[model samples]
Target: MISLPEASLLALFLETLFYGVFFTCYWLTLGILLKKYGIQRDLLLPVATLLLCIATAHLIIDFVRALEAFVLNVDTIGADAYYSNLASPLGLAKTALYVTQPTVADSVLVWRCYVLNNRSLLVGIPGCIVLLANGAIGYYIVWCLSRTVAGTSIYTTIPGLITTFYILTMLISIVCTTHDDQDMTALISWRIWRSRRSISGGSADLLPVMIVIVEGGAIYATSVLALLLAFLTGSNGEYPAMDIGPPVVGIVFCLIILQVHFCVGNNPQPHSPSKSFTNLFGEQGEQNVGYGIEQMIEETDRSV
Candidate 1:
């Protein structure tokens, strides 16, 4: 018989796992869009924002359905519970945050697309329309989230590794000259290419640790390798965050499918990103040991 707290913890764990898979798919989609279609950076940001907002909404709804299990007693769940839960000033604030998420994403898209991207006649005239509109809504949600729901499941939402990375990056960004996707890529490329004969030079030992940190150690080495594919291409910097979940999950799922073959050691291995260099630049590309650490690319010639 599992205790109630144990059950709750189990639920939380499952929720986290499911969300991890969820995020992974989005990340893979985003990666494909970026790689092949060359999604506009400004466009991509709002789409990310929209996906997050939608995910947040789904979370809130599920929380409502699960109130009895996670919050007040199971039998006590009722109209009173529903009404009372939102009665707290804090609860109300959180509720506001939840409601406004979609609006914020929608409004931002409108502003960026219809206003800036379109070079709307409504924008350049400088009426402060978009500024006032965005500020009002954005700040409203910030206040709501800040006030609501007693901080909620933030710990589960962002894994320790990613949360820590964001915190450190934000702190450094406050003062240091910021490096964008390009600058980081150049550094990574030079390190990996060390004349191309060897594809193992830029091993930030800490990076492989991130795989275990954000994701549990259940996945196979193949999945981990696929998760590392972008890094092999020196394009890891192009991604904003881990971007591992979906690909890792896919890798794991495939591995599960290929288990018999793997056990027998008879199946062909899946394509390796190590081959991407070879794919892009051909045979000579594989031999690209041209430079080492000092070659930070100020800009990626290709679009991000």
Candidate 2:
């Protein structure tokens, strides 16, 4: 009914709580697997550290908004319209209003022109692009890894499931965008349109690849743009303080992500009934599998 009291902060809290649980589950399972294998054991801590920091930042944003609703009695500070407009590629003039930092002026300006100012993920269009890119890349890599390790595409029964889920998730995520059928169309871009189109049986793979391109590029692009801004604002060839927070967190994330990417390997797309680090790395993999499992479970719990 869209009648929830703004002061309730129900949706806000729920989203935070929901993602928290999801994030935790993902890491804990991953940790459990890692400890069991003992592969790159040292990385466990770094990966956890980076995730926690990012989670912290995310918490800060969510809690502040929640507090505002509870204390100031403001749901959005009347900034939704402004933010929506700023999220558009067409509203260049309006978007420029947010960048008041002189130190970040030039870098932010470039980003505005090339990346940030456009209708990227924050706007929902480009984020799809990134997701598709990941899907395609993830699929192909999985296929290749299967052949390398298992000598067949049917390496394991699970990779197919993972692949299926991956594709399905990508499709569902994009299709779920409700930018159309209401006042939201003005804010919608090709991604939202494509999402609707997919649900309506209008597209080939449900969501278009272009959506992934924009999405994956959006955040990293934002970070890159921010880093560039730091330099323009006289970073003295050093990472700026404001920028460090994200990069410190992001780089660690990237490393762990890459490591995991290779860890799972593209092997036969999946493995056998005994699929795991043990099969992948042998007795050595089994030695620390428990530790890896714990890290994964703990991470999942914390995220929850």
Candidate 3:
């Protein structure tokens, strides 16, 4: 029942809030990556920076659009009219940024999965195909939106494309979440199971589950799922959900890196099981963890 202007204002407010959280996490993540791997040794720093830039741009665009709607053009075009004009440059730019941010995030995720599976062609092929499809559909949605007449509801104009785009978004997130959970679980569980004879604590048994929980992509996946549902149900909730997507992507990306860095750094005993576990992520095994994580740990140990 919310009007388009109300939804736009609400979305800007929520996006600003999420952007604050993302900025904090992003800086902390940058610090850790710099201390552990520096710029030359790791690609994650650049990737993270790219994500931050995109998210910041999205936030700024939202702010500008909100200002134009509620303040600058209040007497002229009016708030509702400003927001309802989807073909405006700012509107189109916002949509393009939204599409780009998630595509980059999902690409990084798929790359991580490929690395985790030791660069297997099977994993790489399927992931690339899905990623291409995702990008194509996402941009196509943007293109469709751009061509629609002003003040028309997007859901009404191209309902099928909107639905397809969100479904693909959800599908990508779900696939990444599933692969991350399964791979992390298998690696940690196998290690703990092997070392069970030497170790005596139930706490160690929980490490696999804990690591899987921390590293899993469930948070991003859940958000996308919620967005898809909101869109499908034709609710105003989709506006805020769409607005939150960029920051959510950044937050999830940074959290995974930060978690891995601290988890490795906290247990630095020379012969600790955690060290052995970290080692398993290197080239010696068929199953690998993310390159950034492995490199961060190695560099941290060298500095110590």
Better of 2 and 3 by TM-score: 3
Question: Tens digits of per-residue lDDT for model 1 on 123-154?
Answer: 33332353334345444544533443522432
* Native-to-model Cα distance after best TM-score fit, residue 214 in candidate 3, in Å: 5.6
lDDT of 3 by residue, 205-295 (tens): 4443345444555677778788888888888778898998988888877766555544531322233344343432322221222333353
- Cα RMSD (angstroms) for every candidate in the order listed: 18.4, 22.2, 5.6
List where candidate 3 sits over 4 angstroms from the true fold. Answer: 38-41, 178-211, 264-304
Highest TM-score: give the candidate number.
Answer: 3
TM of each candidate vs. truth: 0.30, 0.28, 0.80
TM-score for candidate 2, residues paired by index: 0.28
Please report the candidate that would top lDDT against the real structure. Answer: 3
- lDDT score, candidate 3, position 136: 89
Please report, in order, the local distance difference test score of every candidate based on alpha carbons: 0.32, 0.32, 0.66
Q: What is the lDDT of candidate 1?
A: 0.32
**lDDT of residue 165 for candidate 2:** 32
| Error in Å for residue 158 of model 2 | 38
